[model samples]
Target: MADALSQFEHSIYIGSYMSGILYGINLVMYFLTLQGLLRKTNHNSPKSRRFFAIYSTILLLLITIDVAVNAVWGELMWIEGRNGPGGVPGFIATQTAAWYQTMGSTAVVIMIFMGDALLLYRLFVIYGSKYIVIAFPVLAYLAGLSLAIIELVIAGKPGGNFFHGKSINFGTPYYTITISLNIIITLLIVSRLLKLGKAVSRALGRDSAKMYTSVAAMLVESAAPYSAVGVMFLIPYAMGNPIAISFGQVWAKIACLAPQLIVLRVVTGRAWGREVITQAQSNVEFLSNGRPVVHASGIELQSHGTTTLGDAATEKWNSSTKSLGSS
Candidate 1:
C-alpha cells in the first residue's frame, strides 16, 4: 500500500512539475511578445491590449509564485522532487510550502479577476460609441478589486491553509457566479460582433472598410476558442478531480494564452511575412533570371547607358580576346 501511494504521488508530482516548466516557458514567451508590442502599435484593439497587459502581468506574477510552490513541493513534500532548472535567470529555493502555496493561490485569484476584467473590457470596447468607454473598465475595477480583497483578506493563504481551506473553494469557483458571468460575457461578445460586422461590411470596396470587417470577423472567430478557456478552468474551479481537473485547467490557461501569441506572431512583421514556399519561389525566379542569355535586350544591371553582356556573350568575348592578344 505504501508503494502504491508513493507511485501515485510520483505521477501527480510529474504532472505538476511538467506544468510548472511549461508555465515558465509560456511566461517568457509572453513577456518578450508584450514588450515588443508595447514599443510599437502593432495591433488596433484596445481591449486586446488591455487583456494582453492583464494576462502578461498576472501570468508573470504567477510564474514567480509557482516557482516557489514547485520548490516547496519537491524539497519538502512531493515525490518526484522539483530539482531541475529554476527556469528563470536567478531563482533560489528558500520559501516554505505554506508561504509558497499561499502566494500562488493569491496569484491564481488575481488571474480570475483579470479574466473578468478582460470580458468586461471587450464589452466596453465594442460599445464605446453607444456608451461611455470608461464605464466598463471602471466597473470592472470595482468588481475585480472587491472580489480580490475577499480572496486575499478573507481567504488568506488559500492553498488548503487559510480560512479553514475556504480559500481554495472560493478561490476556484467553477459552476458558480464566476463561470456564469464568463459564459454570459462570451454571448455578449458574439452578439456585439454580429452587429459590428454589418456596419463594417457596408464599405467593402474602400480599403479601410476591410480593416474593420476583418476585425469584426476575427473577433467573432476567436470568441468561441477563447470561451473554451472558461469551460476548461471552470470545471476544475467547481469540482476539480485533482488529476483530470488540473490537466484541463492548465489547458485552459494555454488556450487563453496561445491566441494572443498567434496574434503577436501575425501582427509584428509584414515584409517578414513570407512563408518558406514563398521565399523559395522568389529565390528560384531570381536565380533563373541569372541564367545565360544571348540577347542583352532584357537586362537589369543598367550601367553607363550600355548593356552588360550576358554569360554566353561574356564567354565568347573571353575566347576571342585571349586568342587575339596571344597572336
Candidate 2:
C-alpha cells in the first residue's frame, strides 16, 4: 500500500507539472490566435472573427479554471493535508468527490466536447456543408456526450472515484467514443484535403497545393496531437496504470490547444476554408485561341493570343503565391 501510494503521488506530481507547462504554452497560443483574428489587415468576415474570438475566449477561461483547480487540489493533498488522517493518499481519496475536483473534471470534459465539435464542424465545411457527411459523426458525438455526463455525475456522488467502481464503466466508454470520433473526423478531413490538394495542384502548381497539403496544415487541421494523446491516456487508463494520470492531464490541455492552433490557422487564412475548391479550380481556363486565361478570386483576365498576363491577374497571382508560401 505504501509503495502504491508513493507511485500515485509521483504520477500526480508529474502530471501537475506537465499541465502547468502546457497551460503556459496554451496562453501564448491563445493570445497569438486572438491577435490574428482581430488584426485589422485580416480580410475575414466579421462573423468569422466574432465566432473565433468568442470560442477562443471560452476555451481560455475553461483551461484557466482547470489549471487553477488542479493547483489548489495539489496543495490540499500534499501540503496542507499531508499529515492529516491517512496522509496524502487518504486525503486524495477522500477528495475525489469534492467540488474543486468535480469542477476541474467538468472543465476538461467541456474542452473535450468543444474540440470534437470543432472537428465535426471542420468536416462539415470541408465536405461542402453536406449534412450526410456529418450524420454519423454527430451521432457519435452525442453518444460520447451522454457517456461523459453520466461519468461526471457518477464521479460527483458521495464516496465516488474516477478510476474505480461505477465511474470506470461510463468513463472508459466515454473516452473510447470520443477518441474514435476524433480519429474518424481526422481521417475524413485529411482525405478531403488531399483530394482537394491534387485538384489545386493540377490547376495551379504544387506550391499552391501546399496551403492544404502541407504537413503542418494537415496536422493542425486534423488535430492529430489531440487524438494521439487521447489514445495514449486511454490505453494506460484501461490497463489500470498510474501513468494514465499523467497522460490524462496532458490530454486535457491538448483538447484546448489543438483547437486554438486550428483557429490560428483559420484566422491567418492558411486553413482550408469554404469555397477554396471553387477558387482554385476557377483560376485557369483555356480559350479558343489556345492560350490560357487566368482568373483569381473573381478577377478574370483574357489574353487574346498573346503570352502577357495582365497587371491585375499578375497581382492577384502574386498575392496568392505569397499566401501559399507563408502557409
Candidate 3:
C-alpha cells in the first residue's frame, strides 16, 4: 500500500511541475504574439482591431482563471491535507475540491472551444464566405459544447477526475469532436491552397505559386504540433497511463498557443513570404467610361459583387484573398 501511495504521489508531483513549466511557456508566447498583433494591425480598421482586442482579452482571462484554479487546487488538495493528513491516501473527493477541479477543467474547455471557433471562422472566410461549407463543423461544435457542459456538471459533483471510467465515455466523444473538427478544417484549407497554388503556378510561374504552397505548408506545420500533443493526451488517457495526467496539465496551454501562433504569423506578414505586392488583388478593377467594373478572376472573392477592404488584417482574409490573384 505504501509503495503504491508513493508512486501515485510521485506522478501527481511530476504532472504538476510539467503543467507549471508549460504554462510559463504559454504566457511568454501569448504576450509576445499579442504585442506583435497589436503592432501590425491596421489602426484604421476598427472592426478587425476590435475583434482582436476582444479575443486577446478573453484569452488572458481564461488562462488567468485556469492558472489560479490549479494553484488553489494544489494548495488545498496536495499541500493542505485535503488528501488526508500528510497527503496520504490520495485525494479525498470533497465538495470544495470538486468545485476547484471543475472550475479549472471548465476554463480549459472554454479556452479550447474559443480557439476552435476562431479556426472555424477562418475556414468560413477561406472558403469564400460560404455558410453551407461549415454547417457540419458547426453542428459538431455545438454537440461538443453540450458535452463539455455536461462534463462540468459531473465534475462539480465530487468526482475524483473528470476523465476517469464512466466519465471517459463523454470525454472520449468530446475530444473526438474537437480533433475531427480541427483535422477537417485543416485538410480543407490545405487542399484548397494546394489546388490554387498549382493553378497560379500554371498561370504565372513556379516562383509566384511558391508563396501559396509555403503558406499552406506553414499552416500544416503550425497545426501538427498541438494536434500531436492532443493525441498523446488521448492515447495515454484511454490506456490509463499515469503520464496522461502530465499531458492533461499541459494540454490547455498548447491548445491556446497553437492558434495564437497561426494568427501571429499571418498578421505579421510572415505568411505572405518575401513578396511585396503593393495592392490587394481584390482591389483591382477595370475602368469603363470612369465607372469601375469587377475583374472576372477577382469576382470569386466577392459576395454578390461587393467587396470590403476592411478584412485585410485577418489571417484567413489576407491569405485567401491575396492568393487568389495578387498580380
Q: Which numbered prediction scores highest in TM-score against the true structure?
A: 2
Q: Rank the candidates by TM-score, best first.
A: 2, 3, 1
Candidate 3: segments with Cα more than 4 A from true spot: 1-11, 40-44, 82-86, 95-97, 199-212, 215-217, 220-222, 271-327
Candidate 2, residue 260: Cα displacement in angstroms equals 0.5
TM-score of each: 0.52, 0.87, 0.72
lDDT of 3 by residue, 1-327 (tens): 566456545665776776677667667766775676566442224455456556766776787788777677667666676447545355543433376667778889998898888777766655656799899999999998988787677656654456555666777788777877777777776665554454343333466446545765546433656666777777876776656666776777777767666555544444432122222324334345323344344323334443333333233434543332111
What are the C-alpha RMSDs, in order, of all predicted structures? 17.9, 5.0, 8.7
RMSD of 1: 17.9
Residues 1-327, model 1: lDDT tens digits: 445445435544665765676676667677676775576544324565565566566656665565566556555543333443542111212222255555765665555555455446445544442356445445545654565566566444323333235645544543245555655566765665555444322212235334334654445333454456556655644553344334533543453354444434433421111121121122122224343222332222444322343455335432332221100
Per-residue accuracy of model 2 over 1-327 as CA lDDT, tens digit each: 777677777878999999999999989998997888667777677777788889999999999999998889889988999899988877977997998889989999999999898899888878877899999999999999999999999999989988778998998999999999998998898887776665555454567468777878888999988888999999988877777888999999999999999888878877777656444445654556545554444343334332333456446644553242112
Superior candidate under TM-score, 2 versus 3: 2
True-vs-predicted CA distance for residue 118, candidate 1, Å: 3.1
How many angstroms is residue 7 displaced in model 3 relative to the true structure, after the best TM-score fit?
Answer: 5.9
